[model samples]
Target: MAMPTIKAVRAYTVRGGGADYHDTQGYHWIDDHIATPMARYEEYRQSRRSFGINVLGTLVIEVEASDGTVGLGVTTAGEIGAFIVEKHLSRFLIGRQVTEIEKIWDQMYFATQFYGRKGVVVNTISGVDIALWDLLGKLRGEPVHALLGGPVRDELQFYATGARPDLAKEMGFIGGKLPLLHGPAEGDEGLKKNIEKLADMRSKVGDDFWLMYDCWMSLDLNYSIKLAQKAQEFGLKWIEECLSPDDYWGYADLKRNVPKGMLVTTGEHEATRWGFRMLLEMDCCDIIQPDVNWCGGITELIKISALADAHGKLMVPHGSGVYSYHFVITRHNSPFTEIIMSAPNADEVRPAFSPLLLDEPVPVNGRMKASALDKPGFGVRLNPEVKLHRPYAAA
Candidate 1:
């Protein structure tokens, strides 16, 4: 028997909240006065959109096999990612065997090494690599988990990330991670309000609900330490991405300065095994949170997950819809996964990448059965009604 080869690779971009969850129109909790690196500047302090966080939009990649099976991937690189896929990365996929994921990934990475290693370039590669995995799974007639090695557990549990942990509690999540609303630029009053918010949520959800703060790379080391120390009274379970991804030394120091038993976590923006190696080797964090969409896709993620497991660290992937769900169920170290409640007020559960993906599964009461993902490939389809723009093409 012979195998099918990839025939054509296509790329498109979408606007307003798909994979680029920040590219939204009306008020979204994610874009609200959440503390971020740009918050230091008074002009961009009110909303993440002011700093053009949503400029990239969502990049959609599709790989069509010779057998007519097509695999899909979505990420935040938008039109720039589309250009990379069509103008540059498409050659690596077309005419290759569908099983050549690893080879193709290597080629894409090193070929774009000079201009691409992280950021949008790596994001493009990640999207293409993810499409390959989805294509392979469909061709093999198995769910992605079965292709990976079968699920270690019957279902996946989730923790919700949003502004309203109390509502998430009512929704049955194991834990609720709140976005930090204040930063160092706000001074002591900002820090005080930060603790006050946590204190209020604590009082609402009670102490045992497992509350944590997601600083979103907005804090300096000193301010993060101050916030963590104050949050200890509310039994803060973790403090995430408080500093820039490049600050390994600061992360290590923050890890040491945090209250005993309070976990320090980062890496939603970090890419590749080499970048993660720095985090693990430096003892920079207690757990690593990689977004499969942004962290080199399933191909590199498998390697990154192994590295964390070997170092005795948990790899709780960032909230990335079904992408995180498929991989988390197959690993022991991934005891639970994340869901960034996309509901306007975080008052209800909604598919993380809503409207862009059809048949995309959302957790029922904070748990998703392995069977929900039993369909071939990633078990979801790109919503045809959602307009797709092809900005570049290969001749």
Candidate 2:
């Protein structure tokens, strides 16, 4: 059995809800008055869009094999991501063996190391790395999970990230994580409101159902401690990404100061093994939430997961559609997954990357069967009806 060689690599970008879930059009809850770091400024407080959260759009990467099978990867880098793929990263994969993913990933990372260690640069590499894995899965005629070792669990249980945890509770999720709506700038009154909101949701969902807050990197150390202390009364399961991902020391201190049973988690914005190394070694968090799309794809995720597992921490990934699904089902450290409710009201389940991917699976009653992911590759196709713009082309 011979493996296929990479034939061509193409990059494209699209707008309005795809891998870049933030690049949506409408009055969705994700873009609502959710608290963010930019909320300190009164002008940008109302909507995250005002701060350009959706400006990047969606980056789509396609790696075509010699046998004509094309593997796809999507992320939130948009046109800038396409430019990196077409002008810089493609050179690493153009003529290599499709199975030579490790070498290609190494080259892509180190080659762009000077200017690209994190942010959109790593995002582009992540897209490329994911595409390579998808290519390998298709070439091998197995799902990415099977390629990664095999499933350790029979199904994936999910915790919903949305505004309506009450609704999610009715939907059968293991838990619901709400976006914290007030930051330090809002003062004590805002802190009171934050507690009130949690109390309200707890009243609806009751005690046993897991409830958590996603601060979205919108709090300072003092404010985070205050919120966590208040949230403990409602039986909050965890406080997530409360401070900037760069604040490792702050995260460690927050972890130490948090209520006795509650967990302090972060790392969704951090990237690579090195970044996670800083988090784990410092004991900055109880769980590490890496978004597969943003955390250097499954290739780096494997390394990060191993590190976390060794450190006795959980690798609970952020909401990334099938890319996270395939990886989640296979790892022991990944006990459950996170799904971002896309509907405006979070009442109905929508594909995480809706309108961009066809045949994307949504959990039934907040649970997805492992059997549902039996298809080759990542088990979804690009929605051809969606427009993909190629911002740059390889010569």
Candidate 3:
């Protein structure tokens, strides 16, 4: 059989689930008087329904091959990704072979360098790159992990990222990472409350279950150290993204300052190998968390992972649905995966990218068996119920 060539690339901005989408922006709590990290938590505790999860939406990418096999991918890019895909990226991919992923990725990167080295441009590239991977997988009749060199493990252990570690523990997740609500501007009281929140969670989940904080690029070096120091008393597993992704020196300093046992991790916002090279070479973090969707997709993630492995750093991708799962199961260094608790109160273990993906695999008893993802490509489809807004259609 002849290899299938890429026929067209399509981008869609889709409105996913209503309440359960978990928009990160909606969680930001800024109060002048309250002035504490726990303010958001307290607010959430009091009025869960009032803080409605408004849809920030998603960008879905579809790559069609000559044989009519369509492979799907998605990201948080929204209309921006759709524009890039339909206007700029579609031209490079339309007549190329589906197997030319690396070359295509390079072309996309260099072509967009004037206007796009990071941020939404990389995100747009990521969606297209993932679609290309999916396209190739379908054309070859293999799952993505198998194409990446087969699974090194039989099952993938999971940690949850959400508001409720207690609920996550009950659901069989190994650990739960809570988002840090207050930034440096909140002052010393906020720092105390941040530690207090972790302490409260520790009391509920117990010391045996792993507990971590996702600072979400909201803290300064001094605040992070104080929080980490206090967190040590509660046996906190790690402190993630305490500073901006660009602060390599700060990360190095924070890594050295934290308690001996705890780990320092970052890079959920950083992109590509060059971005990660700074993290590894600076010896800034113990673990690197690259989102496969945001960090240039599977092709770039492989490169990023290899660099982390070379440096003896763990490559735990940020929770990005099935896209991360396939890559996690295949790599020895990844060790485990992350699942974002999509339940309203973070009380239930729903599929990570719920209502957006039709057939996403959820972890069973804190683990996803390899069999769940054995289907060709990424093993999921875009939910047809979503209202897709195609910004630009090719001729």
**What number of clashing residue pairs does each candidate have, in the order they appear?**
0, 0, 0
In candidate 3, stretches whose alpha carbon ends up further than 4 angstroms from where it belongs are: 17-56
- For 1-395, candidate 2 gives per-residue lDDT tens digits of 78888989999999988988888777888888888999999899889999999899999999999989999999989899898999988899988999898899899999999998899999989999999998899888899999999899899999999999999989999999999898888999999999999999999998899999999999999999999998999999999999999999999999999999999999899999999999999999999999889889989999999999999999999999899999999999999999999998889889989899998888999899999998999988999899988889986
The TM-scores of all predictions, comma-separated, are 0.99, 0.99, 0.91
Residue 179, candidate 3: C-alpha displacement in angstroms: 1.4
Q: TM-score for candidate 1, please give it.
A: 0.99
Give the total clashing residue pairs for model 1.
Answer: 0
Residues 1-395, model 3: lDDT tens digits: 77888887888886644212434333322112222223345453322233442333578899999989998888878776788888888888988888889999999999999999898899889988988888888788899999999999989999998888888899899999987755566667767788888889999998799999988676778988989998899999999988888899999999999999999999989999999999999999999999998899999999999999999999999988789989998898999989877765677778767677878888988998999998899888876776778888875
- The weakest ten consecutive residues by lDDT in model 2 span 19-28
Once fitted onto the true fold, the runs of candidate 2 whose alpha carbons sit more than 4 angstroms away are none
How many backbone overlaps does candidate 2 show? 0
- Kindly state the number of residue pairs that clash in model 3: 0
**Collision pairs in model 1:** none
Where model 1 places Cα greater than 4 Å from the true spot, the runs are none
Reference-based lDDT, residue 155, model 1: 95
Error of 3 at 341 (Å): 0.7
